[model samples]
Target: MSSRLLKICLIFIAFLFFSCSSSDDSTPSEPDRSYEDVKTDFQAIDFQTGVNDVSIRDINGVLRFFRVIIPEGDLSSNLRPLVMTLHGASGGNPDAHKNTGCFAEEGFAAINPIIISPNGGNLDWIEFANQVLVLSLFDLAINYLPVDDTKVVVNGYSNGGNGAWFYGETQPTVVTASIPMASSYNTFNTAGEARRIDVPMYVIHGENDELFPLQRTQNWVEATRSAGTEITLEVAPGLTHNEPCNYVDHVKNAAIWLENDVWD
Candidate 1:
C-alpha cells in the first residue's frame, strides 16, 4: 500500500477506538445480577416494613449502595418517592439506617450510597467523581426498583451532610430536595459552586456542635439564599454535634420541606 494510504488507515482505526471508549463511558452498564435474581433476593428479605440493605453497581464496576425500602406488604403499588440518605465520616451503611430511622418508618424508599470506606477517596463532599457514582446508583435503583423519578430527595449527616450539599449542587436535575444535618460546608464564597442548586433544602445544625459547628450550615443557607435558592436553616440550641433530638427534628422538617416547599 502507498505510505499516505497506510497513515490514513491508522488514523481511522485510532478514531474508531476512541469513539467506542467515549460511548461506553456515557452508557449505564448493567449489574452482575439479573432481574429475576434481584426479585428473588429481595423477596427473601422482610420487605413488609423495614430497611433493606441492598447493593447496586455503577458502569465502572464499583459496588456503591444499600437501598432502604419501606415496604407495604402484598399491596400492588406503583412508583414511590425515594430519599437517598448518606452517612457520616465515622461509619458506613449500617449507621445510616440506625441514624435515620424516621425516613424508613415514614414509607419513603432511600438508597444509602456506600462511600468508599478506608479512605482513598476524599472525605469532602464536592468531588465530581463521587457525585457521578451516587448518580449512577440512583439510575440503577430507578431501573431495578419501583421508584418515582420526580420525587427523589437527597440527604446526609456529618460528612454525609457535606455529601448531600455536594450532590444537590452538582446534580440538581436528579435531586428534588437536600437535607443536611450536623455538618455543613464552608461559606458560599468558598463552596458557592453548588449555590446553583435551587432545590428546596432543609439544613439543621447544632448550635453547640463541636465537630462541624453552626457556622458552616449558616454559611450554606446564606449563600444558597443569596443565589436565589430556597434554603431553610434551623439551629438547635444546646444540642451537641451528635444529639439524637436534633436528627429527629431534621427528619420531620425535611419531609415537610420536600412536600410543601417550592423553589425558584
Candidate 2:
C-alpha cells in the first residue's frame, strides 16, 4: 500500500475505536443488585410508626444517637427509598427530622421512605466523629430496613449541608443524590472535591440568608457545575438562615423533582 493510504487507514481505525469507546461510556448501566439480594439483605425489624431514637457506638467508642422515622406501613410488601438527613452544627437527630420530615407530608406518604437523621453533637458534621457516625448509621439502616439502594439521598441543613457535599462527593455510589440546604462549601478544595461527585445534587438556599449568604452558595454551585457535576439550585426569596422551617415546601418540591425527573 502507498505510504499516504497506509497513514489514512491507521487514522480511520483510531477514529473508529475512539468513537465506539465514547459511545459505550455515554450509556449508563443499572446498579449491581438483584431482587433476591435486596430481599435477602433486608431484615424484619420492628420499625415503629413514627420517629424512634436509636444509639450505636462510633469508631471512637462514643455513643451516638440517630433518629429513624418509619412510616405507617409494612416494609416487606414494597421497596422504599431511604433519605439520610444530616443536621447542622449543634443540631441533633430531632433537628434533622424536623427539617426533612415534610417528605412524608408532601405526597410521599404512599412511597414513604425510611428517614434516618444523625446528630451532629454540637460540632461540624465535617468532624471525624460525626462523619463516622453518619456513615455507620447508613450501613445499619441498609442492613436493618428494606431500603431501595438506588434511591438513597443524603440531605443536610447549614453545617450539615457541608457534610452532604463531602459525603455525596466521596460516596457517590452509595448516595444516589444530594440535597444541601442553607449551606456553603467550607472545604479546602471545593472544586477538586466537587469534581469527584457523580450523583445528582439539588442545592436549596435562602436568598436573604445571613449566615451562609446566597452569593457564597451560588459561587459554590457554579464552581461545581463547571466541574461537570449535575446540580440544581433553588433560592428562596426573603428567607434567612435561622428560618429553615420555611423551607419545607421547597424540600417537598425538590423531592418531587427527584422522583419525576432525576430518579425516574
Candidate 3:
C-alpha cells in the first residue's frame, strides 16, 4: 500500500475504536416519565417534604390539582399518616385550607401527617364525580408517597364537609376516620338512607350557622347515632357558617382526637 493511503486507513481505524469505546462508557438515557406514569411505575417520584402544588392525572385520565404539605425531614424509615382535605362548594380555596384552615400546620412534630388539599376545578366537591376524583388522587398519592394506609383521614368544610360524610359512610374500609365541619348533608336525610356508617366520624359545626342551621347537622348526627353508628358532634360556640378562618381551633382538637382517641 502507498504510505499516504496506509496513514489514512490507520486514522479511520483509530476513529472507529475510540467511538465504540466512548459509546460503551456513556450512561443509558432514562425514559421521559409523566406524572400519569408515576401512578403505576414507582421510584421515579420520591417521598418529598415541604409544600408542593402537584397536578396529577387520575386513573380515569382526569387532570387534578392538590396542595400537598409534607413534614420537614427524612420520611423513608417510617410510614406517615395521610390526611386528604376536600374543598367546599365552588372549590373552596385549598391554599386557604392548608395555610389558613391549618390542616397542614399539624403536619409536623407530633401530629405529623402528610396533608393533601385538593382543588376540584372549583366545582362542588360534594358531587359524586368530584368525590371519586378526590379518592382517585388519594390512591395515587398512596402509591407515590410513603403513607400509613391504615391511618387515612378525611376532613372537609361546607360542601366538602358533605363529601367527608359520604366517605365516612361509604368508604369506611379505606378511611380510618373523618372530620366534617360546617357541613349540611340533606341527602342523608332519611333514617333508612342515613342508617349505617362503618367508620369513626367527628363533626364540627357553627352554632349560629346562617346558611345551614345547626339543627340540620344535629338531626343528622342523632339519626346516625340512633342507627347504631358512633358519631361525635362539637358545636363551636358563636361560630357562623361564613367564618372559615375561625374553624382552626376546632380542627386542631379534632386532630387530637384522631391522634389520641381514634388512632391510638
Selected candidate, larger TM-score, 1 vs 3: 3
- Predictions in order: lDDT: 0.54, 0.66, 0.67
TM-score, cand. 1: 0.66
lDDT of 2 at 141: 64
Q: Could you give candidate 2's per-residue lDDT for residues 1-264 as a string of tens digits?
A: 334223333333222111001111234333343323322432333457787765443223344556778877677867678888877766343344454454334423444788888667777877766655566556556655777777888888888778888888877646889888899884237335644358898888999999997997898788778778888999888989887667887788788878887878
- Which ranges of candidate 2 are over 4 A from the true structure? 1-45, 59-61, 91-111, 186-196
Best candidate per TM-score, number? 3
Q: Please give me the total number of clashing residue pairs in predicted model 3.
A: 0
Residue pairs of candidate 2 with colliding backbone atoms: none
The TM-scores, one per candidate, come to 0.66, 0.75, 0.76
Worst lDDT run of 10 residues, candidate 2, spans 15-24
lDDT winner between candidates 1 and 2: 2
RMSD of each: 11.4, 15.1, 17.0
Runs in model 1 deviating more than 4 A are 1-49, 56-65, 73-77, 91-99, 102-129, 187-194, 244-246, 262-264
